[model samples]
Target: MTRRDYYEILGISRSATPEEIKKTYRQLALKYHPDRNPGDKEAEAHFKEAAEAYEVLRDPNKKRIYDQYGHEGLHGAGFEGFNNFDDIFSSFSDIFGEMFGFSPGRRSGRRRPSKGADLRYDATITLEDAAAGTELDLDIPRTETCEGCTGTGAEPGSSPERCSACGGKGQVYRSQGFFTISTTCPQCRGTGQYISNPCTTCKGSGKIVREKRLKVKIPPGVDTGATMRLTGEGEAGELGGPPGDLYVLIQVRPHDTFVRQGDNLYVEIPISFVQAALGTTIKVPSLNGEVDLEIKPGTQPNQVYTIKDQGIKHLRGGGKGALTVGIRVQIPTKLTREQEQLLRSFAETVKDTVKGSGKQKRNFFKGF
Candidate 1:
């Protein structure tokens, strides 16, 4: 029987673009995957058909040949067979190998040592410490190189011996039709060497857990979520590999008087009703020290005042940001009889003189 068209199997048009072809194939493959549709013969057949379609359509040259001859011109093209389930598995292995830097066909006898794992630690600092920058001494517990046997994992004078199971070839070959695949040797565990006598301190492992102290200098203007990296400060590598790095994540403590926005500082200051009406000079807290700020007379509530060069320093080498002070007028919650009378008298004097006063006829008509 003649096979169906590759594009028809993937539910895509013949003129479909490369992206459309891949998207359709991926959707069909995921829907009919053997793992997702267990023991379903129809789904498995559809999955195989989708994979075969993608293999041809993904390549422009192969797609052209298939389009011209409809699988007849592609006959005896020396393409590997996929008649069995193992053949399908081998095809998947080749696709994944090309994508992730691992192939089942290529293997050397020797195994390369792997690097140590990276370490992460949280570092919390006060807002003051963040502004001024400070040095922090941290004690971190991690794996370090074993001193016994000098990290060789051998007992005193004894040494490791070559693995006899795989003939020191860390990998073993398995035959699959016309192809040979290499897999890590189970007996040697890909090390190609075995330790007859292990070190008592590390027990064949080249590292041990220990506490280490590190001094880190935090730069000024580093806010929360900033990370500082220390090279080669993580766990020691095994079998002479390179050590990993240490990451210090910064966490800034909340401040009572200041709210930071980028490099700028925002602060709310309370001023009396008299100070808001009749200008006054008030002391405001700055990063350096307290500074006198002039409150203009007749200042409205929630009016913002900017003091230049009084904020935190810019993190990216720019000049300092301005300190914005938002003034809030405080009204008396409770007043004595004498104070109430005085405020009443003052309110009556300026009642009709203001622009919004109902009695001011001229100001009201001026807008019209």
Candidate 2:
């Protein structure tokens, strides 16, 4: 079968730079990798096609020849001889490991002892508590270092022995084709030691699951999705390694009256039609307490009034944010017969005054 253009196979332009070409190849390779799309023949074919294209285009001399006369120009040019599929696969595997934050060089020697996995705990606090900053005691269930045998995982009065599988080197070598690769010993898991008589308390795991109470101090201005890290508060490590970290993910409860944006607080205050028409000082709720706000005469609906420094405190350091009160003018929907009659009379008098005022008439005409 005739092969497609290398650039077209990788979905890149002929003039694409080297960096752009490599990026496109990586994306396609990741999407069609055999491990990711297991048992899919079409995906595997596409993956091989993209890999072949990358192998040719990545080299400057081969790319120049291919660009000049296409693939046929490079016929019998030893391009296939220079390309090693194993090397390409290894390079792409390293790219994936770095992207996903996994162990690098999976088959290279004994892997570094795996760190204890990070632990996450959800902490829910009220908006007020978040604004003021509060301390909380959390009861967490997690794996801790075993007190029995001091985390040795060996039976009392006995000790673990060096693993015979890897001869205490913690790694085993294997020959694939002509290449020799070293990998961790499956028996001892690269620890180089094994407990002959396992500890009954921890069952040779060197750790036990227990409930612990931790005190956490939450700073002010912490919103939902905020995360705080506590050092060395996570799971116990294996074979005397360092413990992992604990992450406290914050979840702020919704407030009854206020919505927070960063440090700013927003709230909608309803004002009667009479209060909006006539200027008055009314008390409004704030983070600190109730504060009086002056509503100007002839205030329109959705007008915002800002109170300085009355919002949430800054999470880092420095000044607080402003509290914005959005005024919502409420028009009365229900009224008594007497109130309806009075309102109608008031409306008629206002119309008569507008007709009598020359300035009001000119202003109305100007708007038109």
lDDT of each: 0.80, 0.80
lDDT of 2 by residue, 217-294 (tens): 999889999999988888877666677889999999988999987899999999998999997898989988999999
Off by over 4 Å in 1: 1-106, 352-368
lDDT, residue 54, model 2: 87
Instruction: Let me know the TM-score candidate 1 reaches against the reference structure.
Output: 0.68
> What C-alpha RMSD separates each model from the true structure?
12.1, 12.5
Writing each residue's lDDT as its tens digit, candidate 1 over 50-154 gives 788887888898788888876776675654326765455456654432322223333353577668889999999988888878999999999988889777788
